[model samples]
Target: MNYEHVREVDPAVADALEGEVQRQNDTLAMIASENHVSEAVLEAQGSALTNKYAEGYPGERYYAGCEYADEVEELAIERAKELWGAEHVNVQPHSGTQANQGVYYAMLEPGDKILSLDLNHGGHLSHGHPANFTGQLYEVEQYEVDAETGYIDYDDLRDHAEAFEPDIIVSGYSAYPREVDFEAIQAAADAVDAYHLADIAHITGLVAAGVHANPVGTADFVTGSTHKTIRAGRGGIIMCDEAYADDIDPAVFPGGQGGPLMHNIAGKAVGFKEALEPQFEAYAEQTIENAKALGDQLQERGFSLVSGGTDNHLVLVDLRESHPDTTGKDAEEALEDVGVVLNANTVPGETRSPFNPSGIRAGTPALTTRGFDEGACREVADIIADVIDDYDDADVKAEAAERVQNLTDAHPLYE
Candidate 1:
């Protein structure tokens, strides 16, 4: 928080911050899980609140001199609850994965059955990948996308629910492009008397702005990242019915974590206030529109988009059909060479390893925040396709890089 002293002590860290700002100003950020927070949010994140250590919830702190910290946290909690229409909200979880873990801690015992979507089929790691704590501590049964349609198969999910008899059912993803059917997922959970949890980390902004359907009223627990689409600081939030507030709070505090980051909570308050503004609705709508436009443009250029297209802000490009000889890893590096940033992801039923998957994931939230619309999205798609088409050609890559620089310069991110 005290960058002046930091500069006096070590100029390297100060130089790193300046370099990061320059990098953000120069590059095109297309990663779905990333976004630019408002200056107000950043200010709150780097405020004097960082000096305090409020170790407990409001009206109940273990440390002294927490009155102001309690006020800031209470504002964040109230704003979050109001913004999401949640009965109860906890703004303490450090990340989305930790929020999911808190939900599990509140409800399920060790080795209890958990039904979640497969990671390769758009699910997140906390949804029970074997390498994650969720899978190691619980019995995990995974459902997958429909092979033909590349969408969730409700029948298959129901069948798995009946067979697995899970204690918890998770509905969410990191790379999925289509909107999830939360009502149907809730029904499936109810059919087996399982607790339904929805991780809306990627679409929290859309949900906040009412562009996407709300899952808070349907799911027993909902977890989200304040940073991604919400455009907040790097922290996680959990919302649930008031009846479960006590269990969830304790689960996050004593069960999973200790002292909360009051600085991040202050930033969360500012972000929630921004989301409640009328312009945030327009921003969310434009994000989806830009994504669809980009997807359409890519498809017109003969690129194979997984799930056909997107109903959200992200599109998953299946490189196998577009560039049969090139892996997504190659496409990712090729695009990055041209200043376009995106991640290589695994498509459903992908034969490639996770380390070097066969799909590229891109989104429009950060670009949209930077004032990009349908036309800019189309141009970006063209640049990305051009780079992929010339993956092996150094001359072509150089030309593409120059064009990318022009586009990025024309549309500065922060200015």
Candidate 2:
């Protein structure tokens, strides 16, 4: 992965690029939204298509010399349809937030009501955080997970929907660690004659592999990030039935963005093709198994996990109850010092601020990609427990760092 030409032109940027490669190879990536893409995906994303400007959908571009761009975009759309079984797919939203924006721009009017889960309860900013455009433009209301069980309060959601009469009811999550009941949310949306937008941004690969319940057929609009569990390059996708296809296409292109990132679309096509293979299903299943193992070990170490455990690729640990003195940021910094990478996250019924929350989130997609299994993940959990138990102890961090090096050595990446 030497950036020979890049070094000749821009040595500083090349150094940073190589440093990132080394960083990924040396550290554990437990960030829930991150994954290591295949070399094929990497190659496609770095291809010459990045220079092209394909302003419209396949075969209907606004510019000439778009034959190859059209081919890549069409392949991405077709492969996405096959992977997710959607009647229509838009692969040009740039990111999951943009994908959500497409749905809002297409169907929602200014000041329209939006009912979604609370961010501290596992919802995304695109759903309706005050800092995001969705919150500023729409009349937003939020629902919560059960504080006791750490699961979605579907009955409460339904009750809220009936009262709020939102234009759209959003399902799916970012930090929650359980299987979502899409049907229940759909019913809530139906009861109020509102649209359902299920943003499966975190579990796109699981849904594609049938490990998680798919919302494509249940929700009116389904959106996801291509990179999370899908092992695609960084991009967003929107899927829908034929009824809203026309609206979504323009909403993503002319309405939201100028020209599509055709290189990323090519990467998506390649990654989707890779995901269609039988091995990807096993990978998805193993990702869940690894997360369960990681969470169980954390629990046995006297840590508290949201929803008790995970049904997907990530686990959410609430440090407030388990380690009263420690914050998520404290644990996150200590873990990173030991080469274990994750993030500080907000748990349901959060008491602390979002920046320094009470919970830590971890996932196994990147670990599983590096060929880590349940036992390896459990060992990683033990290291995490040690760090969190004694974050200020240099000796403890040193020992954990040695173990992390051994783990990374055993599962080399980008070789």
- Whose TM-score is greatest here? 2
lDDT at residue 248 of model 2 (Cα atoms):
96
Candidate 1, residue 44: how far the Cα is off, in Å: 0.7
**Residue 349's C-alpha lDDT in candidate 2?**
84
- Per-residue CA lDDT of model 1 for 8-67, tens digit only, reads 888999888777877887889999999989889999999999999888899999999999
Candidate 1 lDDT? 0.91
Tens digit per residue, CA lDDT, model 2, 1-415: 9799999999999999999999999999999999999999999999999899989888898999999999888899999999999999999989999999999999999999999999999999999999999999999999999989998888999999999999999998999899999999999999999999999999999999999999998999999999999999789999999889989998988999999999999999999999999999999999999999999999999999999999999999999988999999999998998999999999988899999999999999999999999999999999999999999999999999999999999999999
Model 1: per-residue Cα lDDT at residue 62: 94
Name model 1 segments beyond 4 Å from true.
Answer: 1-5
Reference-based TM-score of each model: 0.98, 0.99
Clashes of 1: 0
Please list the C-alpha lDDT of all candidates, in the order they appear.
Answer: 0.91, 0.95
